[model samples]
Target: MTFEHAKCPLCLDQIAERSRLPDRGYQYQCPACGGPFEVSALAQRRAGKVGIHPGARAKMQQHLLDGKRPRVVFVNTTPNSYYEVREVNASEQTIIN
Candidate 1:
């Protein structure tokens, strides 16, 4: 998948590059503010399930990194909420506020 340009909402700085750690750690940082961004596996799973438009993952990651809550909308509402993810095994699967 093609990656989208990500910008930091706090500093409006574009994410230029990323470095992966040896411990299976991945982080994206803003060059201007040095804020580390997190890309959750749940978010990736959600993107895959919906076949979201290309570059959507990058945009969402940036939003989450900028301190905004990450959410995905689902079509089924009977068994679960529109924003629910089956991949999320528990309520704590999401980041705490």
Candidate 2:
């Protein structure tokens, strides 16, 4: 949510050294005291964890049917190998390679 300057947990000084910066969470050391500083996810609302936006899922499905499948699907980096939708009455199946 909010990104503050990296602070040392022990002393609360802005960490200027490149090596001491935290990669993700706010858990770095205070330059003054060498104590660990931590950023809390609870301090802010996480993005997209609540639920999909209204009509987003339907639009995504429509886009997929239109052959605009994204390179990566779901939580994985692997591409979707295939996709198909069948019309029961027409007895037809459409496959996208």
For each candidate in the order shown, give its overall lDDT on alpha carbons. 0.40, 0.28
Candidate 1 residue lDDT tens string, 1-97? 1233454322445653344323322234556644444334444344445543335444545555565543333344576633331222234232221
Q: 21-91 in candidate 2: lDDT tens per residue?
A: 12322333234433232222321112124332223334433534554431111221366322222212222
Instruction: Quote model 2's TM-score.
Output: 0.23
Backbone clashes, each candidate:
0, 4
Worst 10 residues of 2 by lDDT: 81-90
Candidate 1 runs further than 4 Å off: 1-13, 21-25, 45-97
Output the number of the lDDT-best candidate.
1
Off by over 4 Å in 2: 1-48, 70-97
Error of 1 at 12 (Å): 9.1
Error of 1 at 2 (Å): 19
